[model samples]
Target: MTDIDAPEADVKRAGDEGLDARLVVDRGPFRLDVSLTAAPGDVVALLGPNGAGKTTALRALAGLVPLTDGHLRLDGASLERTAPESRPVGVVFQDYLLFPHLSALDNVAFGPRCQGASRAEARERAAAWLDRMGLADHAHAKPRRLSGGQAQRVALARALATRPRLLLLDEPLAALDARTRLEVRAQLRRHLAEFEAVAVLVTHDPLDAMVLADRLVVVEHGRVVQEGAPSDIARHPRTDYIAQLVGLNLYRGQADGHTVRLDAGPSITTTEDLSGPVFVAFPPAAVTLFRDRPTGASARNLWRCEVEGLETHGDQIRAVLTGELPLAADLTTVAAAELDLHPGAAVWATVKATQTHAYPA
Candidate 1:
């Protein structure tokens, strides 16, 4: 069976779990097309750069964007042509978009009320959802009265109160401050873990996607470039974008035993035993820079490089170097000032063989 079938089989055994979609959406000037599937209780993240159509795919599944072709199946039923309100789908937009004038309880009750529940029944269900989301105290508060994190939770409760079979979140944590994001992300992860339905979230933050989703579908130019578990994708990135996203320096090479001959003009000695086309990856922090090429160092990879640029990130300075091999080196401000490092400075970069990891391409 294909990778797609493997997950579907797991979902069938899990009972009312998962969604399968083959979506094709065409705008006047752009077309987005992709196939995706996730098992019940699975949180799949759609990750990509700006204009990569991550949002478009989410919108298509939510019935907000019409599909030019393809199918959407939840559990076992076809929902390709279903209307947004008619489908068993729940959506939490980037801004949360809660009704500022309504109490949190009423906002959560909106969906069930629209679904034909009695006012009393809807309010009861909404109260239960608010309690579950840890917002019981805030139920009577207006959206404007809640903090960013609290507002996010209310939006989540509103979506869950509808009892959707599939939940869609568009940049769920994008609007929060850094501190709020951390707290909300942890809360969201807990909720997603407890959710029995299939949940798909669209995000540009790698950390958010990695921590929140069981698997990731990476898109570029409106097509899927890679899709797999977060750990797998992080270890074996297939494209430069994925490499950069995960903060690794990747190079294609030909390997024999412990030595890999890189196409970019260097030979790296690694501990991995691999053959044929391979990839070598290391972090910028693993690289050590010297004012002059060393003779007695045990490092297997060493190259003379000219500093191209230097920039500060947090407490560390990242030095961009170009030579036989282009590399990024992270150094302390004290070390940088001591070395008098600046753009156009010539330096030697060295890395131990054990610091480099090689895998089949």
Candidate 2:
């Protein structure tokens, strides 16, 4: 969808939640300058690698870090100079930071109580939130007694209990084990979907970003490299990091009729037509390797490559190759063994032009 179709109501709520920030922070040699906006009912993921300033951006929004420049507006009101507690924003940290001394119910009630709710009212609201998060049965359990997933849900309930217009979560599921991550991820998705305010989450996991956010903001070296729907970004990644994250080999080329010439020196024949600058992408599994270069092959794209690295991913072996074009090829262990492939082995990589997809770059 176009930017015009983006949720204006959500944008207003994001401001109301008190998270309008044009964060410009400098730490000696490093500088983070970014302009961000969020709306109620909008879940935006701040995604990037370590030291890419994802957390710095979040901290700036939450008032933990001071903005060196730029204005912050919440609900059209200024927040650049507002104190953290005075803002309506709620934050869930990477570690959840649940009070170890408090029961599940009490942990959730802390926010509303601090907000000046009476004991009875806070307890009632906390109970209701616990029930919503499926933690009502564990209301009396302390953080130490609860599972990772349960603690995460409690932390989320606590954040929501404050009735803030903007919600912030940092690595919400990073503390869970693989098994628990799957369970909590689905549960988190439901909660995010039901949240009516603007929500921003910071995560390095692509699955978390794709599953939780309506839009993804990819940050690298303190700049947004890409932003779009999960599927759209997955299909058309603009950077090597994004391409690797989305598990596709992306190439830019020019297409004439059925033939596409890659800038990397491989010509592919496809069924698409009418293209100027185009992008071709395929998964590593789509590439086939040959012990010897096959002659008169019907496949349109062929290249000679030297294996740069090899690693096993589950039952499959992933071969990293460098040559006329950098490519990754997936092969079975049996095939790898048959070819005696090593880091310096020579191989022929081929792809049918039909398997190459061309889209406007």
Candidate 3:
């Protein structure tokens, strides 16, 4: 059995038609340079912070924004200058962009009708799509009459009605409330799974990307910082932003055998036998704080740090510690109260050598 958390990259099927593109779009001070590839039945997610050029790259792929340089291809055909409507592509915008006056059926049927389908044929196809989306009973309802999830599904149906070979979704679940997002995300995952073409989705939510996509391409400042299975990236983040995003305290250092001398000041011991520059990372939960220095602790990694700040993180207290090595540490609320952890408090922190993971930088 495969690990449920493994990334899609680890198991991508070979020899299937998919997308191949190296997009470079420049506008004033902003420039997006990213390369992406996907296989048939693959769902690739472009994940990054806001203004990280994720949507810009998607728009370039959809032909809404022309590329300044590089190429766009799908299934071995070039589409550098293809018009948005002419390309074998479909897009679901951030806001759904459903036609307010059109019933759900007409909204989904519009795509087919525009492609020269007869009214009856288009309606038949649209009805089937609505049925697949569990919205057959709402075929006659207008956009306002439907809930957020329903409207989103309608948008998806409309996009798929065109039978696109490549689909693009820009922040597909950004508009939904938290609870609605969870429900719709599961639904979207099912729909994407059934899609036979290459699908690319833009999202900043790590959980969304991890749950819905087979592979994740992390972009930052208009360039791809990392690309891999979500599980691999989570276990070994290359950049500070990625480490922080994955909730790990990451540091750069030089390693010799089982120990790493951090560039920041302190050193860390790990189980890996590595040499040369490397990165050492550990979860905040692995950290233990002491109000006073311990007389004898078995852990070789210890540092005296001053509490810079404290905040609540999902029922635990996250203490921001600054010293030779600045890092975040998580403690249960009960433990925090017992230690009276507060800003400006001095404490000793320790982590076992077994807890720290080191990888090549």
Which candidate's lDDT is highest?
3
> What TM-score would each prediction reach against the true structure?
0.93, 0.90, 0.94
Q: What is the lDDT of candidate 3?
A: 0.91
Tens digits of per-residue lDDT for model 3, 231-305? 999999988888888999999999999989988787899999999999899999999999999778988899999
Top-TM-score structure, candidate number: 3
Residue 115 local lDDT, model 3: 99
Runs of candidate 1 with Cα error greater than 4 angstroms are 1-17
lDDT of 1 by residue, 78-100 (tens): 88878899998899999999998
| 7: Cα error in model 3, Å | 29
What is the TM-score ranking, best to worst?
A: 3, 1, 2
Off by over 4 Å in 2: 1-21, 253-278
Clashes of each: 1, 9, 0
Q: How accurate is candidate 1 locally (lDDT)?
A: 0.89
